[model samples]
Target chain A: MQEILQYLFSGITNGAIYAVIAIGFSMLYNSTELINFAHGEFVMLGSLCMVTFFGSMHLPLVPAIILTITCVALAGLVFERLAIRSVKHPEPIVLIIITVGASIFLRGIGMIIWGKDAYSIPSFSSHPPLDIAGAKLLSQSIWIIAIFLVAAVGLQLFYKKTLTGKAMEANAISKRAAWIVGIPSKLMVMMAFGLSTAMGGLAGVIIAPITMSSYDMGTMLGLKGFCAAMLGGLGSLWGALIGGFLLGILEALGVGFVSSGLKDATAFLLLLFILYVRPGGIISSADVNRF
Target chain B: MLLVKRYRSMMMILSVLAIACLLVASPAISASGKKPYKIGGIFAVTGPASFLGDPEKKSMEMVVDQINAKGGIDGHMLEAVIYDTEGDPSKAVMGVSKLINKDNVIAIIGPSRTPTTLAVMPMIQKAKIPFISCAAGNKIVQPIDPWVFKTAQSDILAVAAIYENLKSKNIKKIGIISVNNAFGESGKEQLLSQAPAFGLAVSKSETYGAKDTDMTAQLTKIRQDNPEAIVCWGTNPGPAVLAKNIQQLGLDIPLYQSHGVASPKFIELAGSAAEGIMLPTGKILVAALLPDSDPQKEVLNAYTSEYEKKYKSSVSGFGGYAYDAVKILAAALKNSNGDKEKIREALENTNGYVGVSGIFNFSKTDHNGLSPEAFVMVKIQDSTWKLLQ
Candidate 1:
């Protein structure tokens, strides 16, 4: 029973990370109507930037977080202006390919800057596992869960309360209508890119202390996050959170009960199963059906 | 005047061509008719396995410089042509082809990682060039490709070293958590094959992926079995994370890691969790702990001092593999008259050659040329390795 609990805690903890990544993906897709493939590289950028700023340069954690997220957010803005915006009437497929190119380009730049060694940062509060009823949860796992909730809640508030959020949603609903209504649709799209990239950077800062940081880390995290986003509901923030958790928990449980070697495969397999059953994700099914 | 100008331009072109030929042939001419012997090296000097390849390349270069400084083999300059594999097998294959086809190297050294070295073995054997590998996989030399030899001690020998240490502790049951790759898989094979002979039982076996950050799930599984010791087989970061996870779970059993985590990089990654975790590796890590009477002491100390003095970093075990390979190849070069077949024969018949890894005694059947004695049982103490008695 305790063993099961341990697995459950880890599964949930892992799912939370995937949730954060999925949220980043969901936000960009929500506003742009184009899936940003380079979304994963933002995660890499976040981690590498943190490692450089915090680990190498000896910046304190709080400032490092702000600086890294801000830097990645600015990168996102540049990516929008330079790569995405440069394209005239690009197909969604073309935008995705460009994002992928952006991802690869970022990875190459990261390699040149950081080289290939896996750089690790000490935890924000490095402590031993909190043992409860024989279940050990890493202190970092606790921090991960807490930060994930804060980000999720903060994003929810941003969407529900902020003027910028409503305008972005209005643009997503119909860019022409939003532009005609003086919502500045172009700014909303650029804001979406910046916000989404910052979210990825935040995931990097939170997770790097646990997984260690490397230039190549973004692809897998991005892929899993994409699966979570797809599973939860495309372009639905709440759906992304749910999807990320489900995938994370399932993968952890699969590794624990099933074959350890097939741990990565189990998540993808669950993705295929979920997608087969619910063509439209749990949250977006209503909106998808109406469309 | 036009005819005279044309003849003058033609003479100028001929003289320029003559100078180019002389410049190209200068080394051959200066060596008194003995052309410089070219050696090709392929190391993953800039990728995931840079920890291994960077040191290997640097050490080989240092050895080559020292040898040339003393004057080349029989007065023929030794030229080293190196390529970076970047830990990719395709690059390794390309490197081998380029060396054999374009560089026309008499011999080749390294590919660093086991998979990369294995990927190029068939090609090197088919090309019939003398190739010495620095990887630790037993399969690399077990079938014994005539042209291939490896200087790094094999996984089977590493297992023996571990078992010998376990016997001293009177611990019989063990668990293994290996990363699913060539190095880890090979270590698993050897551990399973050799355990029963040592009166040991593998109680539980689990594996983690290369990119896995957490091994607590595997460690938790191992914890249920409650083995006397747990062996973690992998390279840095993963094994380092495993060490931390083991500590995090507070699993009290002694953790034994493979030689793949021999470098100080592992200690830095694992932090305080690295303390008291034992592993079997080349004596290079604990060279200072070795007595003066040790045969490898002289070579090990010389290498350690020279490398540290040059790189301003302590020498790692990975570098020792290349250092040993170059020295043995240099020895083989001395006896073989620059003939590839004769060099192969000379390397095969190498007897009582003391190297940093071990006293290498190569035979027709044995290509690795080092035994279990090559590995020293070591435990991390206060962020540094201490040799176990």
Candidate 2:
């Protein structure tokens, strides 16, 4: 049905954002063995970066976006080196607490810097709604989906083809082994953190025009991304993709068929159900524990 | 011996003079003139609810500045002490206690959200200090405590306006989407309980949390019900998310929302989808939709211009309510000459006090100043609200 198609397309667009954020979460979890709860704050900082350098200063979109990503990536490096590196050998719970503390600290700093106001980024294109088979889709949605797909494919190729990418994989598997094999494990972990933060920043920039930007915007997105990552089996990149898209479509369908108020609860309930049936997520069990 | 005696006497005199100066400058010794009338403001100044409180704080600051510029009330400068409730209720009770017992404020202005107001109500009643709530929940003013009054219209009045508008449009079936919080629950109760009386049927109901982003699954189910209208009742960001999801799902039916979505940020967040969405609000907002010659025009214009100049942004109904609250408080102060009991009586006896929002007629039974008649339906046109007939 036309309504079904609309929900599907909208779901994909929203799913793309979740997918992008989840990719970062996946990379950080794989390499550092830390959940990086502050990963969401990186996205928020990226959006705030746009507001500061572009929105307030009226810079061109391209340079503004580049500056935002660079700033966010650098912030991730500083966070990892200063806050995360010290707790690398601590209890896993301590690492989680540290990341959560980082998240709160970043949120507080953002509030003080930006104040509490919502801001929007201008859409990249001025095209009218694209109608296909009784379904209407905005040009912005296409941009978001395209950017997400390109980033995913690009990351895949980088990991498969580049020497640095293999080093990160080795580092993720066993840091002591990677160091014995001359992999420079610490640098690989730092690189993984940088790449993940950049991806989050890019997601922030791409979605800013659609959802607008606010200090608290990243918290919900972060939770949804974590859910998507878990649904896909956190260790599998492809699973993250499928899980994110599936979750998005399910939410869209829930809102379309059920009440809007129950949409979130439905998504969470679906997540619980998925976990019950497939404890390793939608992905195969072999891939679940691969990391 | 005579010289030594003279020098010793001079040094003692100097020391006594220095001690005398310190005593005169101390707070305890300077309490001779009329004591400053302290007014406490409990607001959500630092959290998610800061958006509502920041403007109210600015308005109060402006009002206080103007009042003092004209040489304080009854020759005593008004002192406004504030407590940041952080939009939490338990903290609000503590805030009330601190304001009443420690700061000794004669009156308190708010604990902005509904739950916070409800939490602090007991403390206010126990202390018998006049407290005016700035929140829109009708339940805040009910059971009409003699010391409690509200500057904003109630949720019941807002729902009644929407119901009447639905009738005018001949839309009979409506789906309801609300948050799980106190504000949303109260709205849900009002709509479900009062819709039958207005000849509207509840087609479906959905609920979401404050932090939810995706609501498509719920929207899809509601679409299956094929309701004529979707009535969303929640604060900002929630309603905006619903609007985006509704548009994305291609549910083109009329989306009727609570007054909370009247902010420009809602339109910005909802994007082009915000167009044609209908909501009911007080006259202070959507003022341009009213006739130019209306008596309330001057007040609206003055508030709009002054607020824009002061805050560098457009004014919302929340700011208008704060403006009106200050005016009402000033009127009471003028009448009672800073007598707390007499001011409470004057506030309780407030009748026909024309404000930008509506004509406030507070009585012993009703603490909310406005009725359903005070609202007008407005639709978003090009990111701005236009009156809908």
Candidate 3:
């Protein structure tokens, strides 16, 4: 009834955020074949940057959003150049380890800059909640869902229609082949990091009003986003969307019908069960090149 | 042979001068006629609980400095040896052991949070050093260890304050949601145990992780039960999130927060959603609003003004715990002359000393020395605390 619908709305709101983070994960994984562990820190920086821009600086919403995304995207590029590219050995495990170190470094920097207090910004619009069948939906939740849709559609079109996007896709399929095809694989990797971090930043900005933002907020969000990416079969774009929503819905339902205390355990247990059964993911078969 | 003898004689002079310098620099022999009384402080000054420990550390140092400036406690100037616990139990234990065995402090105060305090309790008892904890858990003093005392109002008192307010409002069948941590767990225990006494029934009990981002689902579930009021217990961010989630979900019933959120930081984090949210807290938040005839009015005004002037920040009740703890220790030191056993005995016999948190009355069986009256109910109005009448 109304309660179920309410849980669904709540799930979708969180699901959209997880979906954005998962796509960020998938982007870097595709181009570099390296999971960017610091991707979540990009999200943290994004949210905090928005707090500084929109909350403290008192800039209008759209400009603040653009500045936040550009700032995080630049940070992503610098991180790639400094941490990822400076590695002596280009081994995947070594690069992943570097990203892990980068994440800790970024988190420490974030703490120093922002301190440990949690801060919130005003929502995109100051409208009242929309009542649908007795379940309340904030205007910000609608904006989040719309933003997710736009990002998904925009990314799909970019990959299908643009030369750079296709080059990045080709690089994901095979680095040697992409190089042979004159894709400039190194540039593609750098572009992937920038694009993914921008997306993560956007997610952080939108969700800040809801979740509030702090130095350590990125760790859990990043972990959950990684879970969503894996559940969506890693590199599958649409699959990430579905996986994020599914995880969110499952968590909400678990908290609603089952014990609330075991909410995280429930989502993770389902994740383990799915990974064991499918070995790939729910939508793994749809994306042949991902494997 | 003559040149070597001259160099050796100069080296001997230099060695004697260095030894004299070392002796002059050593703390054992001070310029003061009497030996300084060394008091140990353990606080989580640089970690997640820094909000509590930072202020506690500052206030304790401020008290010590003020005491030393006025000559000394019976000609023995107070020296504070403080260590950062980083909110970790192992670190706290390490700090306390060093404070006891290495520094040989006659008395110790604080290890900030409940878990750290509990971790180091047995060791303090074994060492037989006078300890005053700043954590609010009832278990710290419930068993009444002769060596351990605390200044923070126990969770039982805060719970009683909440239930008393609920009783006055004729509210029954309240839902309880608490963060799943030591502070929340202790508050939840008191809320459940004392509900029956207040003729209140806890319709639903739920818990959320400390770092949870959203709590809409939990509130939705609570809404199904339709409790008269909801009590959410946790420190900042989680309770702030819960407040925002409750607003988003439009669960319009009365919402009560724990004393954990009794800070301006909570108001800023919760934003407009903080309106009308009530909690039991120390009188420091509403010291300006207290009537003149109140017992704690003068002390609260002095401590708040002094702390705010010194620290350049609004005074928090968490710091008041340390302020009261140091004042209580100084009272004991006055009676004992820095004797450890005498300090312990003196602390156990403290009577009617007005301080920031409350009037103190300690006994052998009751080491905490404050009642439920230590807490007052306050509501958030317009992003500020409004003392509840």
* Fnat for each model: 0.39, 0.36, 0.56
lDDT of 1 at A127: 77
Off by over 4 Å in 1: A285-291, B1-34, B335-337
Q: Which ten residues in a row have the lowest lDDT in candidate 2 chain B?
A: B23-32
lDDT tens readout by residue for model 3, A1-291 = 999998898889989999999999988887777898988899999999999999999999989999999999999998887667655568999888778877877776787799867888888898998999999888999999988888889999889898888888888888999999788988988999999999999989988888778888898899889999888888888778888998988889989988888988899999999999977787784555652
Error of 2 at B31 (Å): 10
Candidate order (DockQ): 3, 1, 2
**True-vs-predicted CA distance for residue B279, candidate 1, Å:** 0.8
The 10-residue segment with the lowest total lDDT in model 3 chain A: A282-291
Give the per-prediction TM-score of chain B. 0.90, 0.89, 0.91
lDDT (0-100) at residue B148 of candidate 3?
95
Q: What ranges in model 2 sit over 4 Å off?
A: A1-6, A50-65, A86-90, A126-138, A256-259, A273-291, B1-32, B207-219, B225-227, B241-253, B288-293, B334-339
For all the models shown, what interface RMSD does each have?
10.9, 13.8, 11.7
TM-score of each model, paired residue for residue: 0.91, 0.86, 0.92
Model 3 TM-score, all chains together? 0.92
DockQ of each: 0.23, 0.19, 0.27
Per-residue accuracy of model 1 over A1-291 as CA lDDT, tens digit each: 777778777788778888989998888888887888888889999988998898889998889999999999999998897677766557998788878877877776677688767878888797778988899999989999998888889887887798887888788778899999999878999999999999999988888877767777788788888999999998888889889989888877887898777888888888888788887776773664211
Residue B320 error, candidate 3, Å: 1.1
